[model samples]
Target: MSDWIILSTALAGFDHAATKHKVLATRDYLARPEMFRGARPNIINLSRSYAYQSRGYYASLLAAARGQRVIPSVETIIDLSARKLYENAIPELEDALNKGLRGAEGEPLPSRLRVFFGTCIDPRLERFGRLLFDWFRAPVLELTLKQGDWVSISKVALLPFSKLDEKGRETLFQAMARYTARQWKDAKSRAPARYSFATLVDANEALPPSSIDSLKHWARIAARMGVSVEPITRKDLPRLANFDALFIRETTSISNHTYRFARRAQQEGMPVIDDPVSMIRCTNKVYLDELMASNGIPVPDTVMLIGPEDFQRAADQLGFPMVLKVPDSSFSRGVKKVASMAELKALASAWLHDSEVLIAQKFMPTSFDWRIGVLGGKPLFAVQYLMAKKHWQIVQHDTGGKPLEGGFKSFSLAQVPPLVLDTGLRAACSIGDGLYGVDLKETNDGVFVIEVNDNPNLEHGVEDAAEKDEVWTRLTNWFIERIAT
Candidate 1:
């Protein structure tokens, strides 16, 4: 069978004629497949590759493909395609197809057909070339190309590790090592005699004092490494530009001031730990569910309830013994366990009055849950949190309102079960490359994700004595390394 090559005229808008010629040239090469035995024959060129400098090439290809006199130059086509992809207000490609191939003023123009194909190694293309080989052979791609209309194409592949050639990889690693050494030297040189860190704490919010103490200790450690820390109020955001970094000690939801602080820090190019996007991902249960599910991570059965009707429907679908939770609340504030339809209705009605989005999850009756902390794409630590006696929730406390004895036990990375470690890594990756805490439930069958926290607390004395220092040391080193880079 003849191999197929798909090239997008708009993506290759720079030199339509040249790109078309190249495609045609490459297609002819594939016809004599024996010439290139090491690589696959399927080739795809995206918008970024052709947009570089292929104008005349694009015009000729567009003319031939559409069979019309109107030919769009490479620059114009690239601008249009880029605008469509990045702009929120722009309608989808399907909508454009419905509008027909006419000038914005209604003049008859060429009928454009969007092409999607798979291939390996286009030296002219940058990132897309690196992606081509893996994407073409990917099992998940099921795009059906139309005869003469645009089709959006997407594919799934593991995060590319070997994309950089040997030289590039070695150079990058050496550069990183040199940078770290230089930063450590600079930190030592700039070390303050008695520096302090100031983090902003909300007076109205009831945060655990241990959380604040943890921030203070981290700040002190940063000072030893030549950075000062301080705590400020929300009223002091204007003066926050003076600090190296601002840590929010309070429990922050999506709608809270912590998010605003993070946004401000981002705009000013200041390093903010627990970024706003991270907070948005962690606080919104709907986002968490979709992200984890799409990434093939196993999570408890969860359904988003948009309204009263949807709430009842979801409850019916999940059946009794379901968890109804507010999308943004934590510490079990707005979380309720409903065992029957009546309880579900009452709880849903009560919660709907205050929040627009709610989640109903099939309750996993597990005795223990695992909390895994991930930093820099690696699992830093893991702990098994067993529920209090006769308590279903892992966060529950004893009758005297104290953390139960032996309720929580820390585990080394080697001690965590293979299943929990695997699931935790998947969940962390799904949330993007960042520091996070993944909570997984050990059910009868296997481990399932319960929650993923962006700003996980790292108190000094929280874990086992042997592991606590290691956790703190690793975290501090990671933070310093990131800032230096």
Candidate 2:
């Protein structure tokens, strides 16, 4: 049987012509289901009268319905179709490349390719049909397209095109083509290697339960990637010298135990998931803002206040409905939105009784924000954090405003906009931290960076359990790969 025939049999049950066409179109993509599992299927509701002629298109339709990532063989067709690859495709491709291609040994090429295809196909092609339509106008174009860009095409591809000269375009295209071919070749040639790691969760009084939960989830993921995870509490820090690497999971302050642990890990020359510098970054929001702004990253308009008088002056300059946040607090703790100068003064006065420094930032009215998790300087997952009913902060609840019970919804990394990912990557690189979380607020003008946390929580079931599992698994595998090399 032909390859198409075999593929068709693999998707035997669908009878719709459009469905069949989709299946065929997405044939190459079905190799990676985990990458496109969230994609919606394409199903046409045409009357039976129009059925027969569309039969030939059934394969493509089926592929679409099954969330396949079909790529046309010819560059012209791809350009003309303007079908952007699925948002998860590039990351999945990157992940596969990082895992199976780069530094891998003795792995079967075809098997790796099949795995890539199976895990990365998106069934929802029609959602991106408009992109294809636009691309049809320009049948050929050269641009760096990441996986996240495919999910939200308008955010990435629809922007103003660079007016590159012919030579520049050719040079860029050649570079991209070479890189793509090299990645593919590498992916097919390598074998997955495994290693071991250790994590230290400081269960200090101020530590939240989420931190422990994150450690547990990571431990399981480490096990899956053939890395033995030894989760030691704060008391076990002295004995952690035997481990290959050390990850500190706690809310770290400049002079906190977590910070000391990071320092020790750095002293040992270990590949800490979050290094000492990251801990310092996470502890001070002023530092985060400075770094982000210097790097041309998008963040809320913020002014640091060293004292109560400084806060009042900054608040006046920033205007009302501003946010007053402590330099070192997470899960929305010590973050408050003040409406007027008097209220701000009252709040600041109360907070000043406990802390010496604060930040007055322009508050974006949107209650929905995005929390993107970046592992190894790449985005792992993103989730929409919705404020509780009638609340502004994500974790605000009724009893002293604890974390909201049902306000947030998690999305795969593929669901985030490319701009968000770009901003996130920039933030990650600025901190040079391997694992961190970037909180973003989408204002009318553009997205703003709320803050970045070095030891961001990775609770197992907080968002989508399955996606979180995949993130942990992939992260562990990545750690092993890096350690082996």
Candidate 3:
């Protein structure tokens, strides 16, 4: 229910390390899974559990197994447990955050840069994100390279903000300073407005939340609304401080650059949509499930599965005709429907291999799922996402796993069902007073909150069908108000 930092030390049992810091021993955390089963906590597992099955190893493993956001995850432990796996295996985790070294000297480095989320600020670092696209799950690694080989790739402790000791607090601030040290002062001529903002987007994204044409439309409308809007991408991190606000049009995730941009914008006192808090709350379904329940919002019968041991529990609770999902998946990518234990086992094993915890929910078939867009703690617009033809979900996949989305019909606020609108508002309010798309299933039984999305799609036709230009104006106005405050 609250933020906690689990000490990596091996105490005899779970006891308070510092009453004020909410720090606990590793064994205590390992012993109590129920304490965190339905709570949203940013757990920093400081236990150095490199051994195959030591107390620290079990602490990290169990924390992840219980679906907590941990640093040295199971895969990290498995790799480190074996020299053949860990040695020479350059950690690709931190590669996304830091790359493109010109160094103190003007000499170029031997290694090339990568930019998978989007292009880098420096064109020389374009290849950096791709080089780290190896899907190494051990996140927040500190990488140092020499003339030939990488000198070191060490895991940095993910300390909870404002809850660290003096040493840990210093480390956190220094790391943040290093990340936010650079600044770009490129100037551009533009029309005058009360303030300026950058629309962060990715032209190369296959299924971006907003299209280039849409941003252009919003920009034209935004100009008349007393704010200058320009399009930028991951390449514009250094130049971000120039703007008064930031609107992220690309999909966001904790592990990617999108989150970094939001964090930086927030750090610089800029009003940002898909703020870091919203991204953290919206991206993970496991957290949403817990949040919805804690707030007494209606959701389908759900079960959290840590491993095969929880298989029987899911079957007994949700039974056949249940849905399985990877917590962090989006756009119906990691979701699947199972009718028997055989299917559940096959799919659960595959998804759990990559993710720490999974979800099994009672299937609620609906004609359409209502997407109520909430901004600044108020309803912006509403739309119905029709189920794909003869499919159970809004988006169905072909034999090759290609996504085919269903049709959507927008709605005026007056026309939306009271229960749907009320449920959507309640769900979004639980997350934060930011931009959210609350998905709810209005079935014959009743209305149930499906999920609250941070960056809900505001496409040209789909979202604007009912409100038209009102959507963009309201969105821009939200930014103007935030900037004024």
Candidate 4:
């Protein structure tokens, strides 16, 4: 069986009809889900009918669920189609759009900040938009926010070049030839050591990939180890089946594409970092509290703040200057430092509006929090994250609400205090062995687990400062081992 197939509205439109790769109608591909699943072919769907509930869309989703490498994986296609999903995106997608339109004041808009919508928008803007989509994984579409309302002027259901002139079409095929040549080699020449893996990352992520420089470094190392690694964004969800394993560098959230990708990748039998179970177990503070408590892991005094009356009991139990957190807070986004009953009441009330209950924990103050990196049930590296200057947490938001982060010092695994490492490993055990960042607070009394993170920051310089390329090489080798076995 061929390794790759193209599912399009019509094969006649494409210039590469003479190529060995199979080109079939989208319906034909949909009709043979079992065949595609058995063959496990990589698919690129060029159907114009990929809107929500469309046959083409569900077929791709079904194929993905059955372990076929279908490009624009159903999850990504659905996410891109739904503009409302980005309404509450981290780093704010809407804010990104606004920033693109209004470059630095008094300076000409950077050439990189362009927007595209078919041929209606300028070519430069189209280039800029494509760059943003490719580089940052920023959600790019025919969207314009006017008067606080989202207005989508167009939909990109099919390849944009369907209407291209003969010359333009030939140019498109030339690009296709180059891409196919690489993919063809990858398909036929994939030795056991040369496993393909896709690392899901976003440019506009809360912790951008560059902050850790993880993607570039990992890809380079993966190549050296006879593995091919691709940096994927939300746009590449459908292409997931092409890889042996998935490493999600993006932050994991339950209500986002990250969760969907984890779930889909798991369903497809791909060994995924931040697996769906890990995401579910790690994202919610409530879950962590129960898991740690049940497993006898040492954690700060914690209780769930359920109602108006429980709030007072929480204060009485944990006392004043407590930490009130939403059940599913991340990177200190929905956490509140309450020093008094009045503050607790107001903050907890506002937080309850978004969640069914809140989490109240005893305030554990320390100069720096310990982050122990655990991969495959073992400690990889350790770091001490100091609180932001004059702030109670590692991240402090400024007047405009952007984050001001604190300094960090990386340490070798052996350098980590034994208790901190042991506690982090114990807490992580309950969640299974994937890449986890276990947050620990070493107090005067004892060390306690703050939380275990599924998609912990693997920032290049900060986490890898001590070991440098060895960090990525070790991580890449983990995936290579998984694929080989």
Candidate 5:
């Protein structure tokens, strides 16, 4: 429910699945993944041991592969297994331990505190237990405490399922009831999605590439296919390994967390949209311009400026009314139309300080620019992005940097001009086989690729208007296919 859940379906066998949640053996879960395919099952692995590659470990691991939700997740079990793996959390956990120890009459602090779903036998330690469970979401945790001026969590590890006592059993159920109870809370369904995807969006972003409602709509379509979609933020980077795939909804930049997130997901071997390679290539206008030109793709007459020396040549070649661009510009921000040599020289002087290279190209004015949505090397949707009223770009920025956008008209792929579709596909393919919005200018001169966007805008009613829900369905299917493969 919050921004981060450093937090699925398929369950495996448990010698001790005493709670109401469903349980299946690890071997059975691995062998019969299809049985719970559409059920979107939530698995609580109660295996006897969770050692490396143990049945418990395999159960959680395999459940994740099939897009089922399981706890303690594979990442949870692994991170909690070793001291070095979770060493950084020790200091924070220690603080929570002391916070619980304060205002205590006490029967003397126990060296070991047993926590069941954030519940504890010692009522004083309940606050510590909840915080511990929040950090590490295993059902049962054993905290090895060290007492001095304050009690500290010296060592914390899983209390093996094989050693649960009768009282421990009671504690587990009570804590679970409190955790899972639907009463007096938001009544929501746990209809297990067939698969799970994490779409990264920045909470504080003023203008995100995909709106929250758009992601929810995609999530809904993904749900119908038994794929669970959850939105995650930067804080959830460590949680990437648990999902089947990842989709980035944030406006991406090469130096930002979005790029790091893309890299992390790819390193985890998950199907990640807006992959890092796409980000690098798409973010630099210099690279993209050269790439399109080298590939024999049609582009505007363009020149690159490394410094002032190339200014006159660029002006002479492209003339006035040229577009000056910083290499890493996006959403039409670092792009400007210079009407005279004075404007070009003034803007280039200021912009070239940060960037080593600037792109100078002929300004081709059109009422609208064509955008083709390409995923997996194919066209998904096409739209005519009408220029902002009395503005030269699809998006115009105010003094406060708020974006004023123009209207759009979505068209079926078949309705798109053949040259436009061909050029769009070529430009997108040159980047990578990932989701992209290829921007092209169609004029009597021909359809010329303006640029390709790694994280394209997938607005709800706008991009999906022509294809209806099929636009989202195709996106979901792309991820599902990649994950399945």
Candidate 6:
């Protein structure tokens, strides 16, 4: 099956003889993203006409919605069509301007810019050029009637498809053909699977839950399971329709791009882990507290820190030494242990600046916290995360700006205490059967549910060490079943 598609109007513009020859030459490797006159599930879209005024743009959007990887995605096409270059690129240009564009001899930039316009240039394009000069401390002149002039100033022109000459059109064709050929060659060599999956992993994240090697290991395991896994970053949001499923290996939060990707994947009917609803439900500690308490799940006594009024009664309601947490905190970043009334008032006031409400829970002291990995409503693996030295939590960021992490010891489901496993499973099942890590504290008193996290850590040597390859195989098998069904 052809994995690449070239969609263009064969009547005009790209219908020229040279352009037609170039497109037809790649016919064996590329087609029109259709199977027997029907649209295929997934294919790389290479269209010549994606202007907002063109029908191709609307068709491309529909194709993208149906899981085709449309080039210059619908969002990109729309954004470009809006022609808000200054609005879109201003944030970057402003910083660059403040730093000042450096000249050859390390001098400041010139004061004037020479500009040119093609036949189909829009007024917005010219205005964009003027705005650039206005922001960058320079003047610009539109060379509407002059050509073939050499100048020291930088030159820019708005060139549309209608103004592109035959040579320019042929150049575009050659570029498309080369790009298509390279994509096909790589696909042939790396992924021979019938379907492709994308794992949203942040390569630049300083402390990603899953390391790059773990992502690679997951890809290798997915390949063995007859699925190709490709690592994608937030920048790949426009191309989300390219894969059969999306596995967000990055941290999941309601206010971040990860949640957006999950939502888009679900809207497109593509199976996605760290599903949007799960992310929304799990990210808010206040919501989790209410959910567990309402469901009769054993959780530490919690009080919603509404304001100073609640603060006066908080210690009496929960305790003096309560754990104050911002609703949407993760990695123990926004959690604080308040040992006294003054401490509670100080920390609560500071945290309240960012969030409207805070959650105060009676601190549960334990040597180690148990994290049970739950997937598909079943217990997968268990780990004991010991508290950081001289710290009350598994992760502690010292005043020196260095992170101190607790040691972890993996345990099989059979080895986990029955009460601990039962409580973790109950709390996780309350949420969807998608992947989760239920944190709990087992003390001499009793086991209590702490929180259920979406997109739980599955590092190579940490969470999956006990299950070995079965961890990835089970996950891949679950994805296959979800996608197939």
lDDT of 5 at 412: 90
lDDT of each: 0.52, 0.53, 0.68, 0.66, 0.76, 0.64
Looking at model 1, report the run of 10 residues with the lowest lDDT sum: 183-192
- Could you give candidate 3's per-residue lDDT for residues 228-341 as a string of tens digits? 888998888888889988999998876677877886676567888988768866787776777677678999998877678889999998878899988778888788899999
Model 4: per-residue Cα lDDT over 307-412, one tens digit each: 5777778888999899988766788878888999999888888876656457899999898999988888888778999999999999886537678889999998
lDDT by residue for model 5 (65-178), tens: 444566676556755766645665688778877777777777877788788877788888788777777767777888887778877676889876657787776777687667
Task: Write the candidate numbers in order of decreasing lDDT.
Answer: 5, 3, 4, 6, 2, 1
Question: What tens digits encode model 2's per-residue C-alpha lDDT throughout 1-485?
Answer: 11121123224443334222233222233222233344543221111111111221222222333333222111112122222322223343334333433343542232211111112122232223223322221212222323331221221122111333455334433433332232221112112222347776656545353567667767766766667887777676666557777666666654445655665555445667667656655656655665576567888887766456576677667888899887667677778888888888888888766554467898787878777888877777787778767777766644654345436687776777888878877787777648888888877799888888887767777644537577777667666666667
lDDT, candidate 6, 1-485, per-residue tens: 34554554343445545432223211222222233233343233334354432344434444433344544444434323322211334444334433333232333323432322111123323444434433321111222221122222222222334445566555555554444444332111111122368999888776677898998998898887788988899889878887888899888875567877886776567778987767766776765775565456899987776567779778998877889998778989888889999999999998777665677999888989999999898888899999998889999976487689889999877889999999999888877879999999998889999989998888988888787888888889878888767
Q: Please report the TM-score between candidate 5 and the true structure.
A: 0.60
Q: How many backbone clashes does candidate 2 have?
A: 46
Off by over 4 Å in 4: 1-195, 209-212
| Global CA lDDT computed for model 2 | 0.53
Which portions of model 5 miss their true places by more than 4 Å?
A: 1-195, 399-401
Q: After superposition, how far is residue 185 of candidate 5 from its true place, in Å?
A: 57
Q: Per-residue lDDT of 165-283 in model 1, one digit per residue for the tens?
A: 45533443343333223312111111121112346676565434236666667666666667666777778766666665555666765444666666555444455656665766676
lDDT of 2 at 339: 89
* Candidate 2 Cα misplacement greater than 4 A, ranges: 1-195, 202-217, 307-312, 350-356, 397-406, 463-468
RMSD for all candidates, in order, please. Answer: 18.0, 21.5, 11.7, 18.0, 19.1, 19.0
Q: Cα deviation of 105 in candidate 2 (Å)?
A: 62
